[model samples]
Target chain A: MRTIELSDRQEKIIEIVKESGPITGEKIADRLNLTRATLRPDLAILTMAGFLDARPRVGYFYTGKSSTQLLSESVNKIKVNEYKSIPVVVNENVSIYDAIVTMFLEDVGTLFVVDDKSLLVGVLSRKDCLRASIGKQELNSVPVHIIMTRMPNITTCKSDDLLIDVAEKLIEKQIDSIPIVKEKEEGLEVIGRVTKSNITKAFVTLFKKD
Target chain B: MRTIELSDRQEKIIEIVKESGPITGEKIADRLNLTRATLRPDLAILTMAGFLDARPRVGYFYTGKSSTQLLSESVNKIKVNEYKSIPVVVNENVSIYDAIVTMFLEDVGTLFVVDDKSLLVGVLSRKDCLRASIGKQELNSVPVHIIMTRMPNITTCKSDDLLIDVAEKLIEKQIDSIPIVKEKEEGLEVIGRVTKSNITKAFVTLFKKD
Candidate 1:
């Protein structure tokens, strides 16, 4: 796919089409005082770009679609599975110290807390850990579940969920990451992770991708 | 600007132009066993979309620019000043506990540490704070400068720098945020910040922006 900048005349053609109803190409050319040959390329471009639609009996009419809408549609097509990273998990009973160590070892900003069945129970962010660190409680003795944002409060996504929606959730919740979970009879099983870093990487790939 | 998928003949035309030298529209048409009138719109579309360039007397030749290249060009045009957030800073001598409190109050992932002269001295990420928290030292007594990622190793950008470059630095350095700085006689001054969150927001705006 390629992007194009509309010419001044083409923009004028769109304005004309927007105001007029299914106007013929010949009539459009006449309105602009240009020949059919001069207007043909602009009309073709407008139609092909989806700004205007042409029918057999009718001439041209605005498609009511803007470039931004098309761009959004393409962006919204990206799924979580395409960009998610391997989720790092720690047992809910693990010490805050151990979870912090695991985070540093994995080089990830967030860690998911799981139960005995490896089902997600909570999320541990750097902020949560840092907050706990400053508290009077001993880091080694206190379990992560006490500090973690537990499930029901945690924002989660599925593999098929749109990445854009996850990005929005990240912004809205002011959180670092979300666990990509799979539904099970027992609970939601953590399968993947999406962070601002992952979103940033996806953003870079957007333009870099061939 | 609008993106459009190229037709099969358009792709073939590009392939032909890539092989041929400064080919004319008539020659391109003849090679494809089509008349110039039939090929006019395709030629116009290719040229307008930047896949091919046309000359008055020389005809048409491939511009050698792919859709990805154009897409990257447009992406690179976005500058750091357009998306950078306010730089949250703390004095270098401040305790790690105080810095963490400031981070919480400001709701920022990273904090810039400055000297009395307001010159950047170090950077403290949430990871840095978390690391310090798990250490043996007292959070209140230990100054941020001792634990913070100090200058000379800091990743920074100017307001005028391309955001893509900053985004790349974030990925390559495996860092959360970079301070947007200005050079001074004394030292670098932090003016703004660019984080993965900012890049994610920019990604969303890329599609949502009109």
Candidate 2:
């Protein structure tokens, strides 16, 4: 097998394809701010190299040798810390109404419930807030802790945990995100979070690596 | 790379690992109704073959080259129809009360709203019911269509769409599941549903194949 190092354009193209594949060359060209004629060489190279598969009218799909190797390397080599985003934190004592505002403001599906010391205590999801706020009129008086999934029950990942394992935990638990915590004397410290979006980012980076 | 054919027992072990990895051989044996002693050889073979990775205290994880290949192939080869589950359907005219009951009974996160002719019209999710039911006193009179995401905006997949592409759609849309539909004279006929669980199943099957 010939190892053809991908150029920046090629890498960017692969990233685009990975994200919204079964896409056309025209669309790919549009995303990269390039004309179809300018992208022909990269398209030909990617499709021929098996990094992409193109049907006559169906456009390009990511069905390549790299898909296998990249997925393998991602599972084995990438760790939770590598992809964890800063966790959206909220105090357990905060009113459910306040928590609702925070959740929407942060644009996160799940919020890490923390104590004053920043110790991870529980998790509040969109469903929890929505359920709690509905049917009642006391959103302000209701504490978030009442609706949160408390610790020791929440699925968490340490910084060193494999990305593959974290992804598995996400699927197994059917949760949107996993808090990346540090086990401390006080409790688990919420340093970061790994979300479903992180996995998608990983997929893009898998192709981005030259 | 040596292509070792997996025995049925080996395949089952891989399945268990994919579902819940970092599992101990003793646990695997217990689940399969075999003694730890009897399962040692298979575990050893798998570990030695690099299909399973074992740590002193971490137990076993699926870390094979095929995991990458399998993930790639699973996404590329498998279509929405192949692993799509039976969809939960409800008539658009059904009361929110009736829809809520059906949602619980079917154990589904979303319901396909169909017309009297069983043509897909809209989709209702757990959030929809939760939101509509809250602050409302007349679930019996309120119809589900009021809260549902109507068609032309619903994220859907055809039976022939690749599983990988479908997974992308799920993440991009951040929805629970996508209805696998077939275009018919009536409209888009809901055939089945594909979910995140289906992706995990594909992951296991990738290793299960000989």
* lDDT values, one for every candidate: 0.87, 0.75
Please give, for residues A1-210, the per-residue lDDT of candidate 1 as tens digits.
Answer: 555677789889999999995999998999999999999878987887678899877989988876555556567778989999999999999999999999999988889999999999999988888888888878989999998899799999999998888888898888889999999999999999999989989887776533
Off by over 4 Å in 1: A5-39, A52-65, A208-210, B5-66, B208-210
- lDDT, candidate 1, at B209: 32
Report the lDDT tens digits of candidate 2 across residue range A16-111: 988998899999999988899999877875664567889999999887455334344434666778877889999989998788778657877789
Model 2, runs deviating above 4 Å = A1-74, A130-138, A200-210, B1-75, B97-101, B130-140, B200-210
**What would the per-residue lDDT of candidate 1 be over residues B1-210, giving only the tens digit for each residue?**
556667899989999999995999999999999999999988887887678898899879888776555556667778989999999999999999999999999999899999999999999999888888888878889999999899799999999998888898899899999999999998999999999989988887776433
Candidate 2 clash pair list: none
> Candidate 2 chain B, which ten residues in sequence have the lowest lDDT sum?
B201-210
| Model 2 interface CAPRI class | incorrect
- The deviation in Å at residue A164 for candidate 2 is 1.3
**Each candidate's iRMS in angstroms?**
3.1, 10.9
